[model samples]
Target: MSRQQLAKLDQLSTGQTLKFNYRQNGVPREGFLVRLKDTWVAYENRCRHIAISLDSDNGEFFTQDGKYLFCQTHGAVYEPDTGLCVHGPCKGANLFSIPLEIGESGVWIDME
Candidate 1:
């Protein structure tokens, strides 16, 4: 696997997300990294139900309570760490997780 840095650890506060853009075979894609409790989690930013972006252009991915990732378009809720859709239309599905590695310097994605 090849590693690419996404963001520095200090760049995100707990419960906040950092959106990242990447190219796959020259096609553009978006991903996001979030700090959850003691670990960081990454997802493809696409909603499981409609395959649309979970957040708007403003990067609003969390619900009002800030405990779950919210899809404003379809009202789907996901577990931040596990990416499991615990509520809404996509209850049985999960967000596509991106393999990530965290180091002292930054958060990195395994591009394979």
Candidate 2:
């Protein structure tokens, strides 16, 4: 797998999300890095309901309790573990996942 150096894990805080580009299926795709439970997870940022960005003003993408990722645009809630929308408009919709792996070097996006 080809890995790309995107951003430092320390640069992100719990409940924060950042967008970046990575190669998938031999094509560049946009994805998001979300900090949760002291771990970072990467997923496609597009909301399945309307195919829009999940983050709203100031990149605020989490719920008030910071338990789940919430889409302010359409009120869709997603599970941080699998990027699956558990409630709201797209009940069965799930965020496309990007390959991610953490190691001694740091978090990395697998572009294989």
Candidate 3:
């Protein structure tokens, strides 16, 4: 399987996020990785309510309180660890989760 590095595990602190691009089946896709308090999470940037980015290019994924993921365009709130949309238009839906592999070198996502 092919993989791409997203961020250095040492560099990403708790509550920080990094955005990266990758290709799946030759189609470019956007993804974001967040270093949550106790673990790491990654997801496709697209909001379930609409095929738009969760953040309005501002790179802000968490709510001001840092308790949940916030979609600027759709107001969809997602539970960071589970990707479950607990509130807003996409309620009952989930964010597309990208399995992440955290290693000493960095955070990686399988590209295959």
Per-model TM-score, in order, reads: 0.91, 0.82, 0.94
lDDT of 1 by residue, 2-95 (tens): 5789888888889988899865555678998898879999998899999889996779899999999989898999999899999999897889
Off by over 4 Å in 2: 56-58
Q: Which candidate leads in lDDT?
A: 3
Model 2 lDDT per residue over 1-112, tens place: 6778656767777777787887777876678888777677888777888977787535677788888887889899999978889999998777887767777676787676
Candidate 3 local distance difference test against the native: 0.89
lDDT of 2 at 65: 88
- After superposition, candidate 3 runs with Cα above 4 Å error: none
Q: Write the per-residue lDDT of candidate 3 for residues 1-112, one digit (tens) a residue.
A: 6988888878789989989887777789998999987789999999999899999999999999999998998689999999999999989999989888887888888886
- The clash count for each model shown is 0, 0, 0
Off by over 4 Å in 1: 24-26
